[model samples]
Target: MFTIAVDFDGTIAYHDWGKTPQFVPGALETLTLWNQQPNIQLVLNTMRSGKYLEEAIWFLETHGIKFVGYNQNPTQQKWTSSPKVYANLYIDDASLGCPVTKPDIFTPGGRPYVDWAKVDQLVSEMVLFVEPIHQD
Candidate 1:
């Protein structure tokens, strides 16, 4: 099983985060599907703190997303946070110059703001095609 570290602001929801963050279309559905899978776990890894993270959790729950965990505090230099064992994957839009270095990280853009369906489709397609590189 693997924990998917998904960003809250831009990945799960749109970049325009507010008191009530609007989820990107299909994001909830994707998370819900991932949650039901026995070999996959969803983790809310975001910069949001305190009540904000709680609110995000509530929102996810409202949309029937049962995540394995949430991380409001991430290591400063290291992008990931302190958590228990095992491998993980991250889904975020702020990954600057990613796929260029790690070509599998960046996904193809769909129809800008109105095409998360295509974006999600592209991500799944990329994941299927990209060979997993083991890190020791």
Candidate 2:
């Protein structure tokens, strides 16, 4: 199985971010499919906290995307005490190495965001994806 960390703002929704979040095309549908994959675990990793966090969470619920954990790996503590969340992949608009496009590429009002089409293709290529559990 693969553990994936996903951001809430521009990755899932549009650049509206803190205010009314507008979803990027195919974001919700892709997440919903990932959630149902038994060999994958989705973790909600984001900078959101307080009220802003609540709004993001609510948005996900309305879209039916379930996550295994939020901001932490539910099963990683058994192997490490580190606070950093361990994930096989991280889907975030602001991720340093992720492919992105300027606001101009998106619809007139769109802002810089992860190119989810590429993301979806990459995620699908790992058909045999798995992670070995380390033991002390």
Candidate 3:
């Protein structure tokens, strides 16, 4: 299975503190599609903690985005005690080379956010490259 770590704020939703912000356009659809893939396991990776983290979890659940792990991969603890979450891929607004939309009215604090359309396209291309080859 391939593990994918995804950030919450700024990546999935607008970067707003103390309150849940609107989901980035196409974020739900893209994540939902990934969640349905049998070979893909998603983990929520973010800086949020305490009640804030709970809120994010609630938001995802309410939106029907089911994930396998949170912050740390449950399967990783068996092999190592590292604090960092391990994944074949990571989707975060802060990640370099990640497509992001320019600051707009929807963005909080005037900060740019993830561009889901570009992200989806890029991920689709990556999947095509890694898909298993079949022979007759």
Candidate 4:
């Protein structure tokens, strides 16, 4: 299976500290698509903790965004105990080479936000090359 680590703030949603930010354009649809793929496992990787983390989880659950793990990969615990979540791909707005749009109304003078449409396309293409993992 291919694991994908996703960021909440700025990546999936607008970066609004202390509150559930609005979903980036196409994020909901793209995430929903990824959730349906049998070969893909999603992990929520973010700096959020405590109440803020709970809020992020609530938002994702309400939106029908499914994830297999959070912060740490459940499948990796058997072999490794590293704090870093292991994923075939890490999707974060802060990462270089990730498609992003110019500053918008939501983020005045802030960094460019992720372009979900592009992300969706890229992920779709990548998924085509990955073979589904089967379990007994």
Candidate 5:
């Protein structure tokens, strides 16, 4: 089985910085197709919180996305939401911060960084589906 952690904002939706969010072209359709597969699970990872997050959930549900979980804080316990499904891909558009790695730049303290580019690349290459094994 393949689990995917897809970011809601810029990744599947067009994020205009301070402007209202918009779904990227083909995002919902792509998601709908992905959901039909038995082994693919789509999870939402975003920064939105509280009521805003609920609103997002409603939106997804309305669009026929029935199997999705939101992790507002990707680095915390929320990661436990879907512990059984090990994610092979995580898609987001921050270009700076990603949960899988250190921040891209040092905080005045000078530590390693999270390279969002690397995360994007890794997710892009992940295989979302595999052929089922057939018994002889």
Candidate 6:
């Protein structure tokens, strides 16, 4: 299965920088669906460390988002000691060409966030959803 590395702050959740970030609208639902799929794997990719990392993990756990790895992948190290997580796609609010919502005061860190609605539509168009065969 292919892997998708998702960012916590600003991507799935709001970008509070230091404080705990809130979940972006529709993010929990979308990620939950992705996690349930059989052909996909998820990895949490973020810059947060120490207690901050724990908080992010706890947030996802509370939200019921299952993931395959965190920060770096175990298999990636066997090939090369790269400090990067191996993923077919990287979803970040800062990614160029990525759709995002307009910055507003209510947003965390007072910054814009990834427009999940648009991202969802784009992802749907990109990935062909094949019906799985049921075994008797």
C-alpha RMSD by candidate, in order: 9.2, 6.9, 5.0, 5.7, 10.2, 5.1
How far is 10's C-alpha from truth in model 5 (Å)?
1.0
For candidate 5, the clash count comes to: 5
Cα-based TM-score, every candidate: 0.63, 0.83, 0.89, 0.87, 0.58, 0.86
* Worst ten in a row by lDDT for model 2: 127-136
Sliding window of 10 residues with minimal summed lDDT for model 6: 127-136
Q: Can you write out model 6's per-residue Cα lDDT over 1-136, one digit (the tens) per residue?
A: 6677888877888877767668888788788777777887789998878988888998899888988777976667779977878987888888897888887776668778877777766666556662222112
Tell me how far candidate 2 lies from the true structure as C-alpha RMSD in angstroms. Answer: 6.9
Local accuracy of candidate 5 as per-residue lDDT tens digits, 20-66: 44555446756776687787777777777787777778778887885
Tell me the tens digit of each residue's lDDT in model 2 across 10-33.
788877744677777768767777
Q: Distance (Å) between predicted and true CA of 115, model 6?
A: 1.0
- What C-alpha lDDT values do all the predictions have? 0.58, 0.76, 0.83, 0.81, 0.56, 0.78
| Deviation of model 2 at 131, angstroms | 19
C-alpha lDDT (0 to 100) for residue 74 of candidate 5: 37
Q: Is candidate 1 or candidate 2 better by TM-score?
A: 2
lDDT score, candidate 6, position 110: 78
Looking at model 1, the pairs that clash are none
Give the C-alpha miss distance for residue 34 in model 4, angstroms: 0.6
The list of candidate 6 runs beyond 4 A from truth reads 130-136
Please identify model 3 stretches exceeding 4 Å from their true place: 129-136
Please count the clashing residue pairs in each candidate, in the order shown. 0, 1, 0, 0, 5, 0
TM-score quality measure for candidate 1: 0.63
- Report the C-alpha displacement of residue 69, candidate 4, in angstroms: 1.0
User: For model 3, what is the C-alpha lDDT against the true structure?
Assistant: 0.83
Using TM-score, rank the candidates from best to worst: 3, 4, 6, 2, 1, 5
TM-score of 2: 0.83
